[model samples]
Target: MKTKNNIRVGISIGDINGIGGEITLKAFEDSRMLEFCTPVIFASNKVIAFQKKHFGLEVNYNGVHEASQAVEGKVNIVNISKNAPKIEFGKETEEAGKYAFLSLKVAVEALKNNEVDVLVTAPINKHNIQSEEFRFPGHTDYLAKELNGEALMFMVTEDLKVGLMTDHIAVKDVSENITRNLILKKAAKIHDSLIRDFRIRKPKIAVLGINPHSGDNGVIGTEDDTVLKPAVAELFEKGIMAFGPYSADSFFGSDSYKKFDAVLAAYHDQGLIPFKTLSFGKGVNYTAGLDKVRTSPDHGTAYEIAGKGVADYQSFKEAVFTAIQIYRNREEYEELTSNPLKKASGNNR
Candidate 1:
């Protein structure tokens, strides 16, 4: 059972061959983590035991048949599978992908059923975790389909938040993929997420340009002038407090990002490169504008350091913390907005 302070966190074990298990276990090594939220790992107890032995970790876990059976102050394992997949370090295998999907599927179901308060996913191998049933580029896309609301990949930290206009698409297709409607939709998502999830009353958003110097008045390209600029103007006029078609090259370099609450980049690399460079080990990839909260570490499955037991779990721990914070923020926001009269009286006081 979860208390007001302790939320149930549903965790999907990403790629059995990667650093998911390592980071997950490492984060829970500190017993203080359990004081805030009950963790429900969607994997087998045997697998977790194997990981513990391999990593030489002494953390104990409670094995249960379902997430609802999870108890506070303990790491709970919801044994989703009887036969645990073999762990092959630093390799992307079909078996690893299978189990990864299984873990994610069950965890998502629990989230939809309201059995879990929030979800913190470990990294999954984008190549191996593909099938007839599961055919999305990443967690954001799949979650958009499963959950209610439009999904935006909002990479966040204490001081920085970056959202992508286009994610998991080829660079050549980026310009075509980014349209006026797309920019409006993504920017709106970012604006709402900052206000609702981050507790920002009003958010200023920066949109990065698509071309060099934002097309340099059509000398380099026309997309920025024709598409991005107009979209940003429309957003601003509609009271979104959005600015830019700012040159991507100099925006972060000049520390212009510090002026805004969040940034909406044209593409994946445009946003992630700067985000990772600045806060790689401390950032959380939050799926914003979703009915439920889902977050992951900024970094992916570090295959090279998968089974070495030296993988940094700071980002994973931060992901957990961010998810919990956002969940609480949403709860508070809903409570305050549910009754306008109460909100008005409280405001007057």
Candidate 2:
């Protein structure tokens, strides 16, 4: 890892035709962003130049051949390809998918080697970015394989955090997937992330039920009562402050989610719909439980507004900030945990 003050942030430009380039450039236009971390964008200079010209933005960068050459306090462009693909705004092409994968592959390598302290990815089109090499549904699935630990799709804001028990799966499979072990694993990941990544001690987690109204005493579904309830009880017994199988329908609408440090929803839409509805432009999609820190904007490739310079860059900027904060928090967490007596005494303070 780099020095604490000079953490290197590796950025993989998402689909070339989308708002990835615009938002990324816009995020660093403030110049004060350099004080937070050194950004290494994994794309060619030609690609970046085209976006800069199109958006009419003035953000300077240092072009380099590799992440190792990235300099502190300056935006660095790690040239992955010399031949820049043709730009077709609001359109998805096989060429765009190829370059997207190339950028992501190189960036992940840099992350694995610790050339970059953290990764802040822009959104990619899931349908277009599919190939023989990249066969996963989304970043979370792919990252779980490339990175060290189980990946948890954690959508977060300062006051609200939501994690998915089963992501990128059909609704029909959600009930079958809600087993004791799955609940335990996801709950444990959320619990650990709250402490290490968010620096929340003794974090309270609420798990939303699999069925409506928590199955209404087994009328709608038995999985909530048979599987989810028991699993949550197990988590509590294991010393994790997890309580739930709470009705998903009213969890967020009733302001019940605000009571806990985080909420683990049974499936994707169950968690994300409410999360996005509440914190769409501001939320950061953090891949928690991974050895390396990774985060991305909550929104996707807004093809409808691509190249229009109308897409919001706040989420992308927040993702970058969140990745840096999580990296520093993990460092602090490791140091504190390494020294038991010091941690104990510090807790007392």
Candidate 3:
């Protein structure tokens, strides 16, 4: 809820057995997060108790039943879980997945009801969450489906933004998925998001090819020449700054990616591999083209170092700050366009 200045952010506690709780505690360790916005963690008191003892960190926690009752002085938690499941650090269990799903569901619902301005998610284990109750591939898919299937996962650093044409698919199947319509749609979405969210008017996008050397002019493959080139050309005609059916081999090596605002990778690893290599711990995995603003750490749920108190909080901190920035930008844009007096205060000419 916004009261002229403060924005309330809903945080979903990710897998308890992973580094979700650990990094969450560490991320908000700074007092600056509370100054700009209030965070309500959709978790339980028992989960907090477990994390504090397991990580050997002392954090002042306040239990609140509703969003309005939350206090900015401490970490305000909504006690959603009645009985915290037996949490074993560094272990992936069905129970952990269930709680993670529950926390996210509560957070999403709160965001939908206008109780929160943005959603900041921690990491979750896909293997553990592939059960009867939770069948989504990951948080992006779940949020997309919940928000009427209008979201795409885009990874972002200060310098780079990477959007996947097809994520979480086998390398062999990636070729078939590179169609003209899909490419055009994702490219348009990326362009729109750059203008609306990132505030970039003429966002340049680099489209990577599916084959080596961009199909070597059809000698190696034809998808790059037939599908990618035509798709890019069509977007160009529409006045979008779309470039290249670039060869994946040389595109990232020469730092050619620095020329574009974002890269539309043909597949998952195509973009993420290089992105993670460049900005692994500092990057933010943002869900673009969504009706609601959402962001997560680029890394996954590190179950190995779950309760070790060694989980780095850099990415998580970045995600929260990014969400807050996007939310504020959106709010400002709305206010600027909606107020006729404010709009006229600038040059009418």
- Provide the lowest-lDDT 10-residue window in model 1: 1-10
lDDT (C-alpha, whole model) for all candidates: 0.93, 0.93, 0.85
Please write out the lDDT profile of model 1 over residues 17-56, one tens digit for every residue: 9999999999999898988889999999999999999999
lDDT of 3 by residue, 86-158 (tens): 8888898888888988899889988888777799999999888776656877888888878754677799988
Choose 2 or 3, whichever is better by TM-score: 2
TM-score of structure candidate 2: 0.98
Which regions of candidate 2 deviate over 4 angstroms?
A: 1-4
Task: List model 2 lDDT by residue over 215-240, tens digit each.
Answer: 99999979888998898899999999
Off by over 4 Å in 1: 1-4, 345-349
CA shift at 194, candidate 3, in angstroms? 0.7
Which residue runs does candidate 3 get wrong by more than 4 Å? 1-5, 339-349
Error at 42, model 2, angstroms: 0.3
| Alpha-carbon deviation at 313 in model 2, angstroms | 0.5
